[model samples]
Target: MNKHNSSHIYGIRSILEAIIAEQPINKIFLQKGLKGELFMELESAIRKNGISVSYVPIEKLNRLTRNNHQGAVAQISPVKFHVFETLIESVLASEKNPLFLLLDQVSDVRNFGAIIRTAECCGVHGIIIPKNGAAPVTDDTVKTSAGAAFTVPMAKVDHLKDALFYLQSSGIQVVAATEKAEDDIYAVDFNQPSAVIMGSEDKGISPSILNMVDYRAKLPLMGNIGSLNVSVACGVFLYEAVRQRINQI
Candidate 1:
């Protein structure tokens, strides 16, 4: 799913209108060294909405949309992003045991969609991803999730580490799935209010975020391949929680 060829709005004015309307913008590509009142207004709107913006050359904006982009192009997200605090507060208001999924730099759109689908199926309360680096909710992603993208609550934050910290402070256990952990996934208790952090395919979880997590657990690899696709691993973790909760009741 290349956003370079995805649905986007061009022209600074059009993009500003979208921002003002609170449309779900996945990413904004602005021309480097751009300046002017309109650009200032666009920047202000972006900051207010917390939209992801990248300062790229005009050529890059042209590549995204060759339709009179006027130095700014914004890709629209198919699914609206929930605010981290608002999402958590809503879950707290529910009084049900919370299950949140956090993706650390998971860039593949298909994997992201599949993870969200599985999260929905497993009764995850919400999904979280960094505003930058993570894949946006595009049409293909929504298709891959079979409409789960709209059903599941998803949030985008400035940093995964801060979200992790906030989740801990809110009394939600932060469990990171990584190969580096000594404890196996089976050993970790997931019946508590929990947020599962799944890392990228190639790099796994970042060391800094891993250091902040309360517990690190891994799935034992019986096969020689030594890895599982991130979505598959995520489903395994999520269902484990489901299983634990079901039995507890």
Candidate 2:
């Protein structure tokens, strides 16, 4: 077996073993039109685990690795993900006023990394994201996080809406940051158990999510730019929570 990088695993058996081992995998790339018994087994395993997958041309697999990939390559996550329910339950037990951050399909790795860094700095207890649409925790994401990716606990769920309901049922107030909300970030009571949700870069929070949140808040915009970058806005929102909690102490 040829191991190209720590972030990637090549060859069919290697990937299947990784899956069987329950390693944190971001996604798997399989070569189109390539079918074998082993390949079929790998496909079955992937489907059973509900792993994200993409079938691409052999040239794409080649681009991912120069080694003999044997028509398969899997991108490994640099950090292990926490189970959503377990993480929330543990945090609730440990922290009196736990703080959490949720990302609504934030696709940019750099933005996700920066948000993780800021969440760590703000003393957030955990971060939650949807499994598929969110950015994968690749090596680049770790680098961009300045090692904060490892420091902050992150949980991935099959659906953000389900995660939101879980958090709310656990007594955490969910607040969404959006330009459309009338209330500013200052109006929200972040001193209590709170989970702040930041939306994607291009599109803001989804209306379905927006409706479910306990509060929808927006940053006060003074400049010509109507909205801030997702990372920047996330920092501002989290620090506001920090500022409140610090003052309360």
TM-score, per-candidate, Cα-based: 0.91, 0.97
Q: lDDT score of model 2?
A: 0.92
Candidate 1, residues 1-249, lDDT tens digits: the string is 112234788888888777777888899999999999989998998887777889998889777875777898888897778888999989978956898999999999999889989998999889999988898899889988989999999989988988998999999999999999999999989878999999998999999999999999999999899889999999999999988999999
In model 1, where do residues sit more than 4 Å from their true spots? 1-6, 32-35, 44-49, 57-59
| Model 1 local distance difference test score | 0.89
The global C-alpha lDDT for each of the candidates, from Candidate 1 onward, is 0.89, 0.92
Q: List the residue pairs that clash in candidate 2.
A: none
**How does candidate 2 fare on TM-score?**
0.97
